[model samples]
Target: MRHTWRWFGPVDRVSVQDAAQAGALGIVSALHHIPTGDVWPVEEIAKRQAEIAAGGLHWDVVESIPVSESIKTQTGAWREHVANWQETLRRLSAVGIKTVCYNFMPVLDWTRTDLRWTARHGAKAMRFDRIDFVAFDIHLLERPAAPADYDPETRDRALQRFRAMSDERKLSLSRNVGAGLPGSADGYSLPQLRAHLETYAGIDRDRLKRHLFDFLSEVTPVAEEVGINICAHPDDPPWALLGLPRVLSTADDYADMLAAVDRPANGMTFCTGSLGALAANDLPAMVRQFGPRIHFVHLRNVRREEDRTPCSFYEDEHLEGDTDMVAVIAGLVAEEKRRKTEGRPDHQIPMRPDHGQEILDDLTRGAQPGYPAIGRLKGLAELRGIERALSHLTYGLS
Candidate 1:
């Protein structure tokens, strides 16, 4: 794996020099200054690439050029937005950036009810608690038909939890869920968020999937022409939220997506934590099945919901969660070798340790999700050690 860090432009708390110290040789970043639906100028892309290279790292992948909701729904301005995205890809490829990662999760990118969940080890981990989400959807944001979204038992428990919350607790829960999580644009107020959710109300799962296909069908050919691979990220948690549908959450979703576009330029970013959230998604099997199309990766693990809550989980140690980390990495290594032997471009699959827990050094720092230095440094070290051992065992170190 070509270890990389997600840099949110110059304003990011973590600097390129800081990333260098973290032992990452690649920077997974974007021209975030250009808002969604705007074409990323080639000059701007060159400037960012120069900035990353100045720190002795290569701009390996564009973490995203966010897809606009209009494009996702094939509604107002969608054709224009799709054209802009194609232009962005063409510009990015001109600057030597080949891999671009984007997700189709409606409204929020990745939802976490608790920004800070205390672990048994006493470290802080980002979490998604179901009751908090339910309280937000039902009592706070007050989405229509939220009651029917949950089963009887869940609805009762959510009501009980909502009744017990003080005004402040209720407000905070609303903000936490409605406000976008880390790497998202920004959190929205109740009224603003509801308005956003309303946009997706008419765009159900099937419609969203069709929109995604249409967007891909338009962009993939441009990607192929420019030598850029567009990789779609899976839906975080692989479930519906606030009655808004999620389409890119499963293996079948990926199959349908690629088939729609039917181009190698259309690809995937195999985020283990996102897909692994679904208990049925076999991470290793997915790697084998989609290996050829996977151009980038995000490696992280999560403990599933406890019996106490329907959608509760905390970031687990790299080797500790539901995902079979070893087998997943091994499959990637096999693909790497196969690509090399076939005289392919040897796509340096850049990976970042997503959502690391706050550990000893940064316990009180209120570090952002998955961006703390200490925890992710440990994760990268562990993954690298495993990769080295596997490389020796599998290919005898050449």
Candidate 2:
């Protein structure tokens, strides 16, 4: 595996130097300054590359080129957005950055109810409190159909939870749930969120999935021609949210996606944290099954509050979460060996320590919500130790 760190560019509190110091040889990043649906000029790409290079780290993978909402819904300007996305891939390939990661989650990206939920060990980790999310959905957002999405007991629980909150807590919950991730392009106010939901009124799971397949059909050929691998990130939490459809939540979803586009360039970003949130996803089995098609990896873990779908989960310590980190890493290592034996050039997968708990000086550093420097450094160290031990024991490497 090629160890990397995610850097949110110049404005990010966690600098590229910090990533290098954390022992990452490659940087996974994106041109977040570029607006969605715009072509990424080679000049901007070169500049960011130069910036990372100056810190002694090469930009190895793009965390994303945001998939525009227009494209996801196949609505206004969607055709133009697809063309622009192809152009961006071409530009990235021209600059020797061939692996690109993007997600098709509508309206909002990965979300959490609490950005600073305290852990038992006195560290701060991000959490998605299930009842809190339900309360926000039904009581705060007041989506008319929100009640129908939950059971009667759950709706009652959410209502009670909402009633117990103070005004300040209510407002905080609304902000945390509505606002997208720090660098995402899809933050929304309540009215805006409602309007967005209205737009998806008739587009259920099947229709949304067809749109994704259509998108892959349009871009995968361009990707193959340009020698770029476009990997779709699995839906965070791996389920529907805010009444919107989620097609890429399960292993079968990925299998369908790959089959629909049946191209080498069409692939998946194996995000353990996102997929692991759903207890049903067997992390190691999925890795072994999709190894050939997985182009990037986010090796984080989450502890599900319940043993079912739509339950709350907190980002847990990488090795301590429900997912067996050792087994997953071993599968990935085995996949890399298989690729090597098959003479594939992309044998070594690029992986980063996804969302670490805030600990040590990280508590004061105030880095991006889930991207504390020292915490991720610790995660990377632990992951590296696991990979080394697995290699030595399973493959006889010293």
- Best-fitting candidate, scored by lDDT: 2
Per-residue CA lDDT of candidate 2, range 1-398, in tens?
99999998888889999999998989999988788888888899999999999989999999898888888888999999999999998989988997999999988788899998999789999999999999999988999989999999988999899999999999888888887756665578889899988888788899999999999999999999999889999998789998888999999999999999998889999999999998888999999899999999999999998876799899999998799998899899899999999999999999999989999999998888899999999999999998888778556442
* Error at 99, model 1, angstroms: 0.4
Q: Candidate 1, TM-score vs. the true structure?
A: 0.95
Backbone clashes for every candidate come to 1, 0
Candidate 1 lDDT for residue 301 = 89
The global C-alpha lDDT for each of the candidates, from Candidate 1 onward, is 0.81, 0.91
RMSD over all Cα atoms, model 1: 2.0
User: In lDDT terms, how accurate is model 1?
Assistant: 0.81
lDDT score, candidate 1, position 207: 84
Worst 10 residues of 2 by lDDT: 389-398
Cα-based TM-score, every candidate: 0.95, 0.97
Per residue, candidate 1 scores C-alpha lDDT tens digits across 1-398 of 78887776676666788778878788888776677888988778889988888878899899888898788777799889988998898888887888999988888888878776787688777788887788778888888889888888888888899999999888777767766535556678889888888877667789888888878888899999999888999998688888889898889999999888888889999999888888878889999999889989998889986643246777888878888898999888888887788777845577887768789877755556667767777787788877778889665442
Best-performing candidate as measured by TM-score: 2
